[model samples]
Target: MTAPLARDTARERSRRRAARRNLRSALLFLSPWIIGFSVFTAWPLLYSAYLSLTDYDVIRDPRFVGLDNYAQLAQDPKVLQSLGNTAFYTLVQIPLYIVVTLALALLLNRAGQRAGLFRTLFFLPKMTPPVAVGILFLLLFNGQNGLVNGALRTVGITGPSWTTDPAWIKPGLILMSLWTVGSSVLILLAALQNVPTELYESARLDGAGFWRQSWSVTLPLISPALFFIVVVNTIAGLQTFDEAYTAFFGAGNTTYSNDAALFYVIYLFQQAFEFLHMGYASAMAWVLFALILVVTGIQLLVSRRLVYYEGGQR
Candidate 1:
């Protein structure tokens, strides 16, 4: 009994030593991430939350106002307008982006030997910087001499002023947003390639036509990619800033920055930096964060019903 007890104790010590070594290695490897999160991410988030409850400007110390900023948000017309703009952008852009990307992916998937070249060509647009895209879009959508209007003139069609016209500003932004659909197309293309050939064969054998097979088999198989694109693009649409700002709110162009292009993030930026309303901006940021959380949660809930994972239970 004593001999067996000694052997078990030795084994236990060896296991404990191995666990300690593993833990030390893990901590060593994770130290950079831990430090980065604490310094940059976690600290900023906590500080912002605290700031949201105070009256803070860059030059002065924060004074506790205890939700005054949030209360004021209810009556702010700009806030409401910005939220509506963002919501409209999110609702319109996400579905259009998904549809366009999916269609491009389907086309590429059917391109046979030319698929790789087509994919590379399609993906090139995503590599273009957002600022550059915004500038390009501004030039393209210029009311008088822009390429879009120029083409319309050639066809004897009068194009609306896309940038200056309130009715067309959001539509112009949506059109600009479509330029970055390459990433979604690539994701869906990858998902499409992974879809089993056997499934397509089975689908065909059942007398299912191309559209019917695509509706049932292709869509279900690629639903995960679709869900990912929808969630990411919706969040991006809600936080739109760079494009609109670059196009309409450039330095010394305050007069051109109309209410129609006032996205939530752009408004928050104007509050924080331009107007020196740090606390109010912080509150707006938190509100935006909450909105994103709620939207993502709803999407997750809906996805459980809609998205499919092959060979796995729903």
Candidate 2:
């Protein structure tokens, strides 16, 4: 071969070698996540989709039934009731939690240096395990002698049976959730700090009241964080199984009080593990995914109008 031709061939070989090395490095970095996804998440999701199309109690071999589970879901009054309860809780808790947490952030933001300590105090609840939080709230809201009712009785206000009464159980859960406003507060606090000090100063110079300043300056700037917290908190509240599970143990048992806290996921768990209806649970899971996706899509579309982008659309 000529010397020039030999050099070109060597260069081509070098380029191919470099490309192969890059490909290997990329795969090496991705291997852990790829394995995890395949084993833990992907297989289960795909299998559940398959299961949703079948009739599989854990004991039996899965039977191929087309859409009966879904059709049954339509006629299932318990499913509808659980969905309604979850929706109601989401509607109430999402707004209340957002408003309260944002207000706390605003209060802390005004504090400046002391804000860190106050932030820590508020965020201590976030450090807690949800299971512990549930148990703690359970004790706090116990009917016969609870902290809330005890304090109320001292001042001549009688506290109702929070855990026992079906009418009052969900509200009690909402109240318990108020203690864990820490995550939202942190998100809000970050947004509050990012708001240009100039904006607030200018509003003050313009003789704008606190409300006016918040309306014109703070709210617009913090809208992104507000939207994020709203979305996350709504989803969290909707899938509120942990708290309800710990609070309303033995719900289907004979001794159980009014069936007040039969949350959707808890019911799903009961149907799947407790009742051994895997197919039914899989169908329930798909319906939930659809509901959440629909709600989220609507919110995303609506947020274009409601959530003000700081410098206006990017």
Candidate 3:
């Protein structure tokens, strides 16, 4: 009995040693990613949360102010205006993007092998730098001599002052967003191509026309991609800043950035850097994070009823 017990103990020890060795090797391989996450992602998130509760400028140590920053956000008219601007942009741009991209995808999908050139042409705009795109848009939408206005003039019509007018600013931004729909077009095109051809054949046999088949068959089958594009564009629209900023706040421009162009992220950037309201900016960041989470959750819930999966499970 003692001999057997000694043998069993030896085997257990060997197993424990091998487990520790494997763990060490695994951790060694994972160390770079683990360290990067801790240093860049996790630490910043934790520090930002802490900073949100305190008043801090680069010049001084953080002083605790509890929830005062958050409370002040409630009374900030600029915050409300920015939020409304972001909401409007998100609501308008997302649907229009979906419609336009989906239409493009459907058109390309029907083009079969001949669509390669068109796809490349469409994707080129997305590869353009945002600042460059903003500059181009500024030139095109110039009130007088811009190409858009020139074309309108050729047609004996007038174009609005897209950059300077508050009413047209959001629409200009929406048009800019539309230009980057190449990614969505590619995604939806892939989904459309993956759709079973037998379904369309059956619809044809049932005497369904183009619109009817598209409604009952194509839309239902591609709903997942549609849902994905909607969520992504909504998030992007809420965080819109670069194009509007580059256009309205570019160098040598004396015109102040009006409320129409003051998106949420841009406002937060102003609070943090321009005004040196670090704590308030951190609070705003947290609020934006929470808003994104809530909006995404709501989308997920709504998608359960609307989106269709091939496997029939949401």
The candidate that achieves the highest lDDT relative to the unseen native structure: 1
How many steric overlaps are in each model, in order?
0, 0, 0
TM for every model, in the order presented, reads: 0.97, 0.93, 0.94
**Which sections of candidate 1 miss by over 4 Å?**
255-257
What candidate 2 gets wrong by more than 4 Å, as runs, is 1-16, 250-258
For candidate 1, list the clashing residue pairs, or say none: none
Q: How much does each candidate deviate from the true structure in C-alpha RMSD?
A: 1.2, 2.4, 1.9
Candidate whose TM-score is highest: 1
> Model 1: how far is 295 from its true place, Å?
0.6
lDDT of 1 at 306: 95
What is the lDDT of every predicted structure here?
0.91, 0.87, 0.90
Model 3 per-residue lDDT tens digits across residues 1-314: 99999999999999999999999999999999999999999999999999999998868999999999999999999999999999999998988888899989989999999999989988888998899987888888888788888999999999998888899988888977788889899999999999899999999999999999999999999999899989988888888888887887666455634678889898999889888989999999999999999999999999999999988776
lDDT of 2 by residue, 97-180 (tens): 888998899898889988888888998988888778877876898888989999999999999989888888889999899998
How does model 2 fare in lDDT?
0.87
Model 1: per-residue Cα lDDT over 1-314, one tens digit each = 99999999999999999999999999999999999999999999999999999999989999999989999999999999999999988898888888899999999888867888888888898899878887887899989898999999999999988988898999998988888888889899999999999988998999999999999999999999999988888888889998888888866466453688999999999999999999999999999999999999999999998999877655
